[model samples]
Target: MARRNEALLRWFRQTGWTQRELARAVTRLGQARGYNVAPDSSRVRRWLEGERPRQPVPELLAALFSERLGRPVGPEDLGLGSGAPPGGELGWDQRGLVTALQDFTRSDLMIKRRDVLGTTAALATGAVLENRLRGWLDPVRADAAPAASAGRIGTAEIAEIEAATRTFWTWDAKVGGGLYREAVVGQLKAMTDLLEHAYPEQIGRRLFRSTADLARLAGWMSHDVGLQGTAQRYFTFALHCAKRAGDQRLGVEVLSRMARQMVHVGKPREALSLVALARRGAGARIAEAEQAMLGTCEAWAWAALGDAGRVDRAVGTAQERFSRAVAGDAPSWLGYFDQAGLSGMAGLSYRTLAEGDPGLAGRAEPHIDAALRLRNRDAYARSNLFDLISLLGVRIVQGEHAEAERMVRRVLPVTGRISSTRTVDRIRPLARRARADAARSTDAARLAESLDGLLAV
Candidate 1:
């Protein structure tokens, strides 16, 4: 506690913030925004003394400090640290498949809630996700090795679940999340239960890998259904399962996806944190193919965080690593990361950073075009949505409404196919702009109405 308090003090002082100044800033921001807040001096004393602010108030505190200070600040900013001990949050980092599955029961409950998480809640999650990635090279060793499996889960069962998951993934990706999120979540819960009781350790690891994939899909499904808290929980649960499988490569992939979620919800700093962890995890002892996959993901995160230099470095690393990821050279576990996937990731990263760097937008398009040419439906769906977003932004800047509208019409229905929340969220702003643009022109009335209808739904 003393060490934590000292760290908090150092952070505050280094940021040029006094306890009184921070409190004053928080109160002023709150009052201006119509929130009732206590005066700065009292709040400062309480915060400095280690009292955690509760409720809607916590959001206000984070918002006020972050806005004024020009960096992301969470509850930890005020000297209130996690309720869980250091690396205690990383208990999810436990390596035994069974133990990780057991821990999901707690995480599942947290995911199902609808309330806004206070900074502490989010920070706790961020900590777990980040730690898993950062410590990938030196995963916590398990006390008991998993018992060897008798055999694979019957071929029939594996086939059944795989087919269903793939089908739902396709359906959700194309139709809207409103299509089959509940069904997928239900399937995941049931599968998790069955996998827990029936499978031995080695087979259980593979089962848990599938389980984590499904869990992440469930999280994406939740995001589609607008249950962010629930989605976050699933993502966290998926991370645990990935760790349990000793699949750090896939674990980093899941974290990258989680970072994408953060970016969608307008939390770019947290997204940066997740990506940093992914890069840290991929630094050593991972397969070359896995290294490329993680590097590409980190590139995306840096792009989202508006760090051009890091984004370029990561993209370069991703391309080089990806070149080393030949079919003969890489593990079966890494086959999903083909040339098209890497290119899609590169395009997506550039598209994200394009807003802050127009020149990069031009550079991003060729990759986006190449990715689209490959037409891996799901990967293409992601690339198209992001490309549309980037193009729409550029069009808006250049006052090219007709072109932007054309892109929107082509992309919206395409976006409708994937089970990606971030993709959907990205298109919303573009749809809004299109409608507003359409409203201004005599010929655009019908187009504006069409866009408004899409946006309304």
Candidate 2:
């Protein structure tokens, strides 16, 4: 049998197309390009299962994704190209960065278009991003020079954008990304437009840093609402902005978020690679809290791999670093990862750890409870909901039928109020484990049904 064509499948799902829809869209695209080809659901299925289309079809597919992804998407990206192309999709220069940002905010890029650009995101591989960092670590003088356009902007405007980013972040944590993604994108578009003008050296760096912060927020919110590919694209460009700002810490933080995305997609080894690169790039004297955050990320990756020893060491390192954290030692960007954040991350690691070994359920509960207790009722309510589900997952694993039932009964009703894809993702596995065990009680069966209803999976 042919290989399963995971590359094509990954992009296909990222496109959020039903087999029939993809078939119809590609067929129409081919016709528009003057190729009289007929493709249906079966044809799409074959492509997904490792069958390459005849000449011109793969090219059409590439064209479709290139337009949809806002970046170059070749046949290689979809597993239909020849000659064993390197496993990455990263080739954008400084000039190309503006084009990428502009493509993201196109008015024509609506959800119901030929492909959902913002609503569904394609995954970016770790190799692709780390490759970009090669340029970031060392910058050229020409790239750093002030814009040649008629000079105008200053520090005041940069301050406003930075404040707006912080505000949006707070909103994202309180409300889900689905509610305000368009607003974030719109602001991001306006911010990108400002780059056309000129500012002095200090103001220019500040502007780029502010833009980087906003772009990362846009990416985070995109990921929040299930737009994985869009998130990656935003993050890739945010890295571009961070580099332009000459801000090493921000770049490391962006990589950390990318690592989180990897973990979410079950690519923990990739996640580990990203975190490792981030630490190595930061060098020896990273701030205490940032060090803790990075360590927690490492522990989470270790937990995903079921490496208990490594997980313990990483978490221990994180906690130790967190204790020594001094006021103002971290940058303003570090505000989000406070005591509550560290506790929640530690809990999440153990919860992921419990996935591979249910006996570790006890290890996860206390930290999650601490997170639940410490998280601000208004600012981090959405996260609190996620932690509640973490609690439920741990309970289910520990064989607490009645308690789990009570918890889900309460949570099931409230979850609909939240609108993050991460929440949906959290429910997915808990729903699976609840239904899989025949030994589970009626309460467990009902809980699974509720979760399935929420997910419709």
Candidate 3:
């Protein structure tokens, strides 16, 4: 009954793959991500005859096509669905970043998940991200504001916005951004309205910096709540505003945050690319605290790629840079990247590596423990909860299922209180692993059951 999928037929022919071949390829790709996919020739034949497969099959097919063809491919490209890819890529509008921000916020306020992103973080970026990164690496001056509007906000207004942003940021770490992201989005919309107006050049730059910071926080919160497409808009908006304000520190941080999102979603190569750009853009003048942060991001990306040596090197560099940072010397905006933060990043890096090799779980536990020991549990309740989960993961992988079972009791309650979708995202794979090992150990089965409950929110 479907239109016979001419688009899919064309790609199938171009790839020179038979129905069986495509089926096998899709199955292999799916299995790599732990999906129990077992599609055969008949399934691929049905697809060609206009039967669209389920959630991840279309994504897998698109990824396969992209790889074989050496270009970006989305389900829509094969006429299987609609748009560019699941993680939406911002086109970086030609009119201006501000215009794009305005348009994005308008749609966001309407509560529609309209953008097209990669089907999953599992899909390789292929050419799409490379092209975007090229644009990021190039120079492009922002549009100048039309002559200043008569009414203007002064330093006091800028400080207030900054203070508000700091508060929202703290909320993101303390309670997760699930409920408050809408509020942050509304605030950003207001900032965009003010940007449309004008102030003194000094006042304007400060305002833009504040807006950039607010937008970045919005991005972080959106991501916390699992709005990846919406989050990308805020991240790019932050970059545009930071660069427009001539704040290298803000720009580098924005890029770094973007990189973290990429790594979070399983696009490690793209994550590494963003961090490389951030490092190069920061130059030698960048502060030690920022250097440490960037190094940790770089380490995470490398760990995703399964390069333990590179992870070690990056972790070492981060530790050294963090050591060089004078107490209270980092820009106030970077206050979160303290000793606990470094240890968490390091622990997370090893955790990422160990996920692929349970033998390496030992590398992760010490740092995770150190982070838990140093962190202020009350102030960073959400972050502490995430660390606790990470520690549980280490225990499970280390075959210390009894200890991991004990941890699930502590972590499960706090996890329920925290609204972070990232906590869910982070734990899902671990839960899957536990479930897989459950047949062998009663303790692992129990751990899996407990972890599964925490995944509900």
Q: For candidate 3, lDDT tens digit of each residue in 158-251?
A: 7888888888888888898886888888899888878777566788778788889989998888777776755765777787677667777888
Which parts of model 1 are misplaced by more than 4 Å?
1-90, 93-167, 170-178, 195-199, 282-285, 328-336, 377-386, 412-421, 431-451
Give the count of colliding residue pairs in each prediction: 7, 3, 6
Which residue pairs in candidate 2 collide? 121-228, 121-229, 122-229
Off by over 4 Å in 3: 1-95, 112-126, 133-143
In model 2, the runs with Cα more than 4 Å from the true position are 1-93, 107-121, 144-147, 438-440
RMSD of 2: 7.4
| CA-only RMSD, every prediction | 10.5, 7.4, 11.5
User: Which pairs of residues collide in model 1?
Assistant: 111-230, 173-417, 173-418, 173-419, 174-416, 174-417, 174-418
TM-score, per-candidate, Cα-based: 0.64, 0.79, 0.77
Q: Between candidates 1 and 2, which one is better according to TM-score? A: 2
TM-score preference between candidates 1 and 3, better one: 3
Q: Rate the local accuracy (lDDT) of all candidates.
A: 0.61, 0.76, 0.77
C-alpha lDDT (0 to 100) for residue 327 of candidate 3: 73
Comparing candidate 1 with candidate 2, which one achieves the higher lDDT? 2
